[model samples]
Target: MGEMRAAVLFLWIQCTSGWMHPKCQIYDSGEDLGHFLKWTCNYLPRHAEHYTAACEDVTAIEEDLLGLPPNINTFCISMANGQNRSMSLGFFSQFQDLEYLYIDGCFTQILPTGNIHLPNLQHMYLIVKWGMGSGCCNCHIGPHTFRNLVNLCDLTIQGYRLTAMAPDVFHGMTQLQRFIISEPCVEDLSEILCRIMNIKSLIELKIKAPEIQTLNQSNCSILNTKESMKPVFNNLASADFSFGEIPHIEEGALAWLQNLTGLSGAFSQEVLLRLPLSGIQQIQYFSCSGSNEIDIERICNVVFLLSIKKIHLANANMRSLSMSSVELCTGLEYMYLGGLGSIHPSPHLKWNFITSLKNLNRLNIDFLRDKNPEICSFQKQPITWLTKLTLLINIQILFAKQFSCLVTLQYLDLTQNLISNIEDFAFMGLTNLESLDITQNKITQINANTFFGLHSLTWLDLRNNPLIHNIEAMSFTHLTSLKQVFLGQVNNPLTEPVIKLNLTLIFGGILSQLTHLYISSAMRPKGYMGQRVQAG
Candidate 1:
């Protein structure tokens, strides 16, 4: 009895003496504290050493964060109303072994200012939500604020109201590798680049500023000329400049970035022409989006000069694309062209360019109008050019007579179109086709010979179509290799209940090799036995 009393007394002393009793170690102060504790005790008892505190109507932070566990490595503090709260200096003095700190939706006006030191800290994320309130002050990164975080490697600051960052804000962070600023609060791009040039080890940098317009010599001159005659970002391999309305890229501006391999942005034809041709030729991947009419001549010139393997163009007018122009980039393997508007290429123009791409393997083109019967007149001419093509997406109608040339095609997507019927032998020559998606269309019924020739087809999707209640059983009988079928949510008027389907009769013996089937409840009638079909 005496020993039991002594043990109990010892535990009580530890709890009050800042030794952190195992049960009372992790402290959570929030509106859902009771529920959080119950869940932690039941499922995550091993992680009870972590501490999280919710800030509410608090003017000071030192009093609430004092006397924490000495071994605490991760600390999370979130403000219920970030606009009303702020952080002060020396607030993290107790957590000496802290490595990761996350401050979400907090800190307004300014961060802590002092000889703040976090010896072991490696990753920090500060998200300030100052834009939610009206007439609120912007957050500022004061000088010497992050001076003592010598070991910090990754830092992310995301806030709409961040207005200014001192030139030397990241001065002492020599070990920083990845820095991301979403809609940065800074006003000048030059200021950001000047500071980023100091970090030599950074490999990936992303700046998403929608308000900025034009990246010219003023902001990008640092990359053109280096102080020590060395590359500014010696290791920068990938850079994204998603600024709005970037009209100009001065010549020799990006020359110093010798190791850059991938660049993505919406650039104008004039800006593209002015780019350092030699430097850009070294890039292996390029993605460009713009509203200006695509200059086929200049684009072809770039393709001929560069050894790029993949090219993606969005919102560019391809009305002027010609066979001769496309034939210049024979080295390209993957091409994705989208948002082409209502322009439809003639049958000869489409066939000529596609057949000319001898090295092309995957092609994706969207937003083109329906394939007119006039375009199918080229069926008389044999198209033995697409022998190497494997995948085609968002192209015109897939009439078997017109597409029989692509004997090696494996995957085809004909979704989001005005396709109402799949005429007999629509995919007759595609013996190697593996997957086909005809979803989100106006298809009403599947006739017996609708899919007569897809011998190697393994997966078929007919979801979100207005399929008739009664389907011909032999419609899919030819697909002996079929493995999965999706027939969920047949399009029906809101006022009417979904029409049920008889699975055993519709699928017949086609389910012999089927492994997976998806159908909605609306497609099943009352008193239906799903297990009986599997048993048979």
Candidate 2:
């Protein structure tokens, strides 16, 4: 029968070139459209998820000029400029149901040749282009290059001058669980910490390779073994070399990751005043930053580890942080110290070490270069399991019960704090505050008990106050669960000067649970705001 008419003309050219129909018919010529590779191919009117193929002057990559769509499962190959060829992803083995894979720019090598089996590869990114050819140290990693991605699970590798890699280049990823390497002139990390310490299903590990200056005792001697030795990262919990400049880290180079519990790096006040507190006594989320002046009582006796609970110190200038130095941590529950420089305002901030943190819940104190006036007293800091408070402190005034001990504050950020005055019951015992951000302040007027006892306030941000020119029409009538408001201004509309907000007598009866009302068509809105649209 003439071979059944050649199998019905090969299924009619695989259903109109869609290779058996997964919805595909896009051959775009979008982008610049000049020096070759300027491409595009978007199609999804019934299946096919994710397929980029962005190109521009790319030197080599030819899978029939990327006629993608084999049931695409996320695949992006963006490139701009190329040379040191050796590319050969074996045409991705015809996208056998591929799974997330992104490759960007200037590659000098990436040869997953031959039988490139991908068994549903799971997440893989490779971003190059750092000082070009031979600068990212010839960007090569071909020891079986990802050995047929046997279920690879999350693997990122950004090059900024890579070096010392190739320990069988992640042999046959046994389901690697999150492994990131953002190189910054990769300066030897002892063969990448002895090849991901034999990745025992690695669970989160970030390495920023900042010139890897040092980690003493002669390159972490295989993490100073012994103690029965069996610790191949039994599901490594979290490790971030904190973008190394490695001041010093000897004492058992990270106490054999005994189930390490989240730890960041870059600490140098002489390494937290001689840190080695048994190598982070079972750390429990500890981030650190440095630039000097950090003696917060010897880093609170070395990270007050009783399985500490979250403490992120930034830039480290921490002036006079005394209250017996964080009153023995008390299993802190999230605390971020700050610094942007200019500090000399510690007038009084002894909220009795947060009333001995009975499990304090979230508190960020950023001193955006404190420009003077600083006194935030809470008498007996009533952290009733505080919910979330961010203060960019410089403070001008918020007197009357300034945050009445945050009666369960649920998110409050005093952005760019220079507040001009929010006295009368200033949020008196916040009846469960639900998001309030006093953006860029120096307020001029919005009184009517200035949001007294915010009855479960629901989002309000007085944006960039170019000295608000009065707004007291029952100033948000006890915000009956107000729903979104951001009176915007100040980004130099010619040095700002415009105010006419009368949203029906300032949301007369809470304006029917107002659903988002952002101002700033040069702050103009005098009444009638029925169905959105009140000014430019």
Candidate 3:
């Protein structure tokens, strides 16, 4: 009895002396200090307190304070400098609130394979960057790795070089909604693709696997669906690839994308086969560059782009526009075709393409100067059928062609191509043209009657074009409705020598309406000097 009393007294002194400095293992920096302290008390390590009582104290907090009802919701194990990094499976089973877990740095391979049964973890982020460790093996089985994340809604796994997930990485994650993989060197994105093949309920998945600097070269195989399972992803809404790139899925692999109402990408002509929509009903905005290749009919009907309001197809080798290509698109309002390969009008091509588009108000056709050095597919009748239009034509180098009759055209974009010489008959029948943009082109000369029939022309943008050497005194004389003129390239050396408007004779009153005059950089300054000489 005396010895027992002395032991209790000794423990009392130790607990009082050493309990002040608590060692908390798992924590979020964003948590408040008081909350962290409260949590720390539950996970704190005791240095000396009649070890049994210390353990009892921890259990009391785990049960009473954490309110853990024998269900593990979280687990955290620290890795010391020299200790083996694998935590015991018993440690994981001790707490009922073990839904989330984190193991820092590297880990041993033999920690415990197929040892997890966590069904409650809805959001998880694993930060592992292991090397050739002895605790794990080249996994090739099911009910393993991420075996029991069945109810997991969000899972994030990150590492420098995680070779590959177990074949059944997401074997039973039936209710999983979001999955994220941030390993830069996830050379085996295909493995992950296969794992999620059956997760039809997953709505959002983001994959990001760029080349990691520290990883060695690795080979990955093309993904294939399981033979017995014709899994359909009817519920998926959005997917983001690891590197903003994906292997072009086979012909019908993207039949599932039909349900996705919104998609965002800079894909161009060659990758059009990736969008395999069989019955999409609500897609609207599309963006692409020169390399995208998608079928116009497939995109319009099956991809359900009737809801699309804006389209940007620049430099996409688009030579002709067919009426059926845009038949079902009722919501299309703005269209951009600049950077398109062909600029010349192919009269032999169909002209009724834009005639059916009732909602189209803005149309842009950029020059081919950047790729072909000249415009080759500019058809005038393509613009004539569209009853109302805001046109933007950009011709970099000079090429003379008679403008087709476009009576309903409004705003015109003629910027950054080869239009150095302006012909009097170029814009003859454009009666409703309100704005003309010939910026950043090769315009070195102009005729007095260049814009003869443009009675409604209000704005002419000659900015960034070498305009000083091109403007004749009569170039601006006729357009009585011209209100705004943007001339002179920003920082042009000649703009310093010539500031006053010299073309007052072409049409004197037309120059007086010029209220918004911008010379490169006024309210905003395009700081760099353009290489082309504007005959300054």
**Predictions ranked by lDDT, top down?**
2, 1, 3
Model 1: per-residue Cα lDDT over 1-536, one tens digit each: 45554223324233322333323334432123344224222221113454443233333455445545565665554444545445764567567766776655555545643676778777776755444543323566665567677777877776634445555556656778877766664444664576567676777777766555555333434434333332367777676545556676655555555434555677788776665542444556667777765655566567667666777776555555557778677877777766446443422124456655677777776565535322234445544334223222334345655566667777877677667766778777778888888777767777777787788889899887755444666677778788999876543333344344556666667776789887653443444433211211
Model 2 CA deviation exceeding 4 Å by range: 1-88, 92-100, 103-111, 114-166, 170-191, 194-205, 208-249, 252-296, 300-349, 352-447, 451-502, 507-536
Alpha-carbon lDDT of model 3? 0.48
Tell me the tens digit of each residue's lDDT in model 3 across 353-464: 5565667776665433332222224343445434344323433333233444456677666554556666665777778888887776766556677777788889888777
Cα lDDT, all candidates = 0.59, 0.63, 0.48
Summed over model 2, clashes come to 0
CA error at residue 85 for candidate 1, angstroms: 4.3
- Clash pairs, candidate 2, are none
Model 1 is weakest, by summed lDDT over 10 consecutive residues, at 37-46
Which candidate model has the greater TM-score, 1 or 2?
Answer: 1
